[model samples]
Target: MLEVTLREYGPAVSVPLSSEVGRALAASGILQSATPDPVRDGHWLLRAGSRVGAVRTPGGPVVRVMPKTSVRRLFFLLGFSLDPARAWRDSREGTVDTGAYDDVVPALAHAVERQIDAALRQGVLQGYREVEESALVVRGRLRESEQIRRHFGRTPPVEIAYDAYTVDTAENRILRAAADRLLRLPGVPGLVRRRLAHQRVRLADALPLVRGQELPRWQPSRLNSRYQPALRLAEAVLRGASPEHRPAGSGPLAVDGFLLDMNKLFEDFVTVALREALREHGLTARLQDRHHLDTAGLVGMRPDLVVRTGDGRIPLAVVDAKYKVEKADGLLNADLYQALAYATVLGLREAHLVYAAGRQPERFHEVHGTTAGPDGRGVRLYQHSLDLSREPDQLLLALRQIAGRLAGATHDRDHEIPVR
Candidate 1:
């Protein structure tokens, strides 16, 4: 029997595999690192080369493939399944391993259900019972049969053994939804293809249902279409996928990635995603510079992007793009002072600040001229933000709203909202 030990127990419980156990769980194309593939156990095949256990001549430890998993890893794997769209989008950072889907997903339906069943008896899953019955009067009855008014009641409802404190709780719906989609994708190859499709294929969706069918080796529209179709339009790309081909919008829409800069650490992503996202949005974008250049004078200035749409009418729009999980004093202030400096030199009417949208569309406007600068310049500060929690199409509208405000009064609001 495999000895189960708890590695962590606060927010969620985790189990670490001993060398003997880690050796027993090995597979290809899933977990390439030294870390164990906690996502899949069927990849549970032992690595005879690594462990200190007695084995027969045939490299035999009789590794009876545990054909199943416990709730510990089942829910854990389910957690990966939740929001797989976001998961896969983030997977490039090495945050996600292929094992969870390739090896673990198949064995789960049978094993995971049983594990949940076992837990049902202990905690969250125990069912309640309610019974209604009639009662008769006894002790105080005045001789003979006496009428009685009494009743008993019990209500039964099923429960689930849930760890409310687990990350699972924070991501329960996400896990359930992702798991459901994975379960349903077995017969829907097209859906999976679409999910994994390339931008050209999606952009070409209107052109032809030819992604898997054949390549348009010589299709003219491939080079002519103004819109770049999406492989899988997701939260990460919701704003980027906005299909407006205007003077401000037209160009080869690209999915700029730090693919070569992939990092396992989560914080590493914040900077890369922020800068790349800013550039992709046509904000003040700067690519990697190799030479040891001097930024002394530019250390703490403002206006990441400056574009003047009209002829010599303030030749640029000063913009600063900010990326953060949450905004605090340090965050907004950074943009504020930066914009202040930019406005001073450029002589622009206003500066636009942008931030990523989280759960909803939120905005904060800051007025700078409230306090006088050393030289007494009329400094006005404002901050605007977008909530990206809405659908992709809606996010586009939000971006349009920002682009409109920056475009200096040409944005139209009369059209009805697009139903898409």
Candidate 2:
């Protein structure tokens, strides 16, 4: 067995692997691995890509990789505030102790359990759900075909459908299914597993969903407000814990793990936080604004963010978030090219690129003599870096400052008159 320690979104690590294990890892495609170094005694340089999860090989030791950032921090970055009103009354406020668990699954399991327990204490959330039943007495709408098949000669029997407000609801069933899956996951601590089992038993009256069953839709309202947090957690758990199968003859094993794309996470956080900041200035931000990049409209480009006028039709500033470590020299040419394209296509004077802090400092690049704006002026690209290690308040402050800069740039561009 080989022990590999990887930092979240960090550089790759080289590990000596046997041919069988190497092939398996290659086939899994979760982690990016290079060709084995023959000179280094069959050592393969393995890199943990954007994903953070553990993959267990068939009849082999498990390869566990942990994220550098805790799951709690990730939730915060995703715009989930730790408001007491949004948390379970009996549970500790918004903070999750990720250190207590080795992997994300257990941490998530513990968090979900706390929410489920708190929601259940208020009594199983009862909702009116459409129920179809075949009984001797008619209740609502009758199914003629079903009634004929089940009770051909009987007069009292009928197949009826009605709405019933009961504990057995789609929401409860989804929670139960999530708990059941967590219980089966490997490396879930005994305590968490027991709690999950308890939750499952508590939801025994709810219908059990098959592996690939479609979950029911639930809208949050005043009545089920307390269940909102738990429902969100349950949905995330169910999505992440779903099984992914490998091709036949590759292996008989299924990989079950929870991984987040840091790139997307960073982009989303920036967009939301900036939008919040822009709201103060009487502006608004739209994420992933779709636009045709070329005249033919065949190629499409969606910038990570677009700060527009209050009406949202006029584009002011276009921004793209990049979760990458920049070279010591400067921003990557490809990033600059992409940002420039966004500026040109949007007919803006400037575009913004946000990157994760690294060795390189933030700087602005001017594409000299490139006519990008509607007035036939050159475009400017702004590069900003955000340090993810900072506290939540500090992060929001930085975003506010960035929004201020964007607003300032827009103001300057709007007031400028063409010299020509």
Candidate 3:
């Protein structure tokens, strides 16, 4: 199949493609926009949004959208967001070596393959799954009600339910599904595919998930602790990019690919990191905390994070994470207005805007007439920047500093001390 590469938020590039192919690619939802080139016929100008990774159109070019950040950092955000407490610190699933692969798809494949290998080192995990089947003899428990309805009290075939101790549990099935998905997509390195194939073979006994069905849910506990990391990554893989089918009359083509939205990724990572850091200061955080913008509760709002005091529902600080590329004019004023609204609804004197650092520096604006605080300032909207290119540790450190600022503001408010 043909292949073309584009960069996320990069300048639009023109690539030669048929109308059908270009339309299918655009409909696949991997790029920001794809249109026919003004001067060059049979050429399409493609621009990428925050969503990155690769998408393969049915019998068309494999359109890959590369992230602006290094593969290492992107995976770091992914791993950290998947499970903030353990994904990075103990398992290091996010820090897996991606130096060998330049593309996100291969890097994801490499990372997942390594995690799967680590998970299956001790052999496939086996657990008891409740199963139902029609059998000649009763094993665990006979379904008398069903037997009466179906067989009219026949003994030849019995409808029974039993707990089967096998490797066909949810965890193994997820692992199998993820590997299968990666294998079907384009751009996976041959060696990675081979290794993934081996993992699939090892998990052959596990039932593959049915297409278009929701993933089987699994819970974390001491029993499946060894498989938690791989399971988390697998679930992310399965859910991240869904199959975007090409419109009909395209010759029965199936578009298969995976994509991760950096906007959601950065927001999750920042909010989760902030939540974890707040715990150390004896504070609590709610992600996507829901509230109403109007007293009548007609207009609703959900801030990225709301810091609260120890198990209390009252919010102390409101935060919104913006993963936007810098423009020449400067940061948008609409972000400030959004923060102001959140602060006003939460009845707070200040709000926080956390953005991925680019050309903008940290600053705060005071809005007049929105609140009557001790300093007579309406509301304070502080804009903070997190430089994503920093190492993971430095990133977390930056979050801790932001958390400290948030906590300090809360303390100052409680004592009627004006916050600078």
Candidate 4:
């Protein structure tokens, strides 16, 4: 798979695939530049100046820039230029392109701060502070000379120990620019704010590198993958409502259902919803039992979904839908290998390994060419995830992206677009 090793902690963790790794890089703010890995491997491959896995994606250049988070929370900490990815690139061309990316973390931080201030003003999360004024006792000395002993008198207490609620010494520690404000920091790109299992908004790791020392301190944001899951997202929303909590005996996080059959979990409503989403985009796909060639004495393979544009149409793409969370990005490697095998069978030049974004958003991947196709044509791999939770606008946009790519490739890579 994608061998990801840290530059400093290179031996601590070498993951094959991960989205958490991407978030970590964003928070570190050490990389000079960030891009996707040029090689094909299971890991969410990312590359930077002497740094790899800086912003890893499933299979394309669009890496997961932030952790899985909530709409309301992200609304406060982040802002997209309608199509930030496209607009960010257009910023240099002209008038503050909305579709262009500025990824100015500080700008988003200010926007978030304003949103939070508005919310607070509206009593969304309001708190009151009280400070009481009290008189202070001052020590004074009477005349010590014998001749002035009779002149000893209590001097008016001078203004000592002054205190005011409006004025503070360490104001920055208690109140400073919010994350939205800090996001304006030149290097800060996208910021995601979410609470952790500890019921606290993760400010930063316990050992935050600050002031040339690793100190436990507050930060503009945090980097955590556990809170990036659906269950965690749910908990963040339904907090304070002690609805039936999952018992500890429930065991570790796993596929929703495993008592009956493991693979059957992919046949549930979630999977169906995903396929429906693809179809709504004008792409027809369905799950069917398709067996790979089984040399009489050899093994064979089975795919969850054998999708095609239509009959008489060489399958334009092979897709394998996954239901795991972003943390389980490792499981994706096997899926990629399986999909590639399917592409080989149908003589397809590309295959899409799709994922269902339970609580996260869609992660875009660039279209890349890999091994040769059945006809000795170059085979490419693409990765995409459907944001089941996003509005229709997102789905439409995603559909347009795929259609545009296909239309573009026809002219240069092929004579004409395929017709089913």
RMSD per model, one decimal: 26.3, 4.9, 3.2, 21.2
Q: Rank the candidates by TM-score, best first.
A: 3, 2, 1, 4
Better of 1 and 4 by lDDT: 4
The TM-scores of all predictions, comma-separated, are 0.31, 0.82, 0.92, 0.28
Candidate 4, residues 1-420, lDDT tens digits: the string is 242323321222223443444444333333333333446443433332212112222331322122132222222111121223332233233112112222322223333333333322322221222333222443232224521343345343322333333311121212222331233222233323321111112222211123222212222223211111212212211221111112233333111100111123223322343344445445555455455555472556555554455342445555565644434333355665766677777666766555544332333222245555465646555555556345434533554454334323322434222211
Clash count per candidate: 23, 0, 0, 19
Q: Please tell me which predicted candidate would have the highest TM-score against the true structure.
A: 3
- Computed on alpha carbons, the lDDT of every model, listed in order, comes to 0.31, 0.71, 0.83, 0.34
Tens digits of per-residue lDDT for model 1 on 1-420? 333211111122223444443332232111122244468542332221111111111121222112122322322222222333343344333222223332222333332223222322232311122222222322222222111222223222212122222212211222222223233322223433243332222122122221123221211144212111111111111122111111223133211110100111111222233333333345442222111113454343324455543342443456665543335432356666666656656666556556543332333334434555564534444455544333333433455555555554443435312111
lDDT of 2 at 358: 59
List candidate 1 segments past 4 Å from native.
1-304, 311-314, 325-331, 358-377, 410-420
Candidate 1 structure, TM-score to reference: 0.31
On a 0 to 1 TM-score scale, where does candidate 3 land against the true structure? 0.92
Q: Report the Cα lDDT for candidate 4.
A: 0.34
Candidate 4, RMSD to the unseen true structure: 21.2
Q: Per-residue lDDT of 61-93 in model 3, one digit per residue for the tens?
A: 788889888888898888888778764374333
What stretches of model 3 exceed 4 Å from their correct place? 87-94, 242-251, 326-330, 359-361, 409-420
**Clash pairs of candidate 2?**
none
Error of model 3, residue 94, in angstroms:
5.1
Most lDDT-accurate candidate: 3
* Minimal lDDT window, size 10, model 3: 410-419
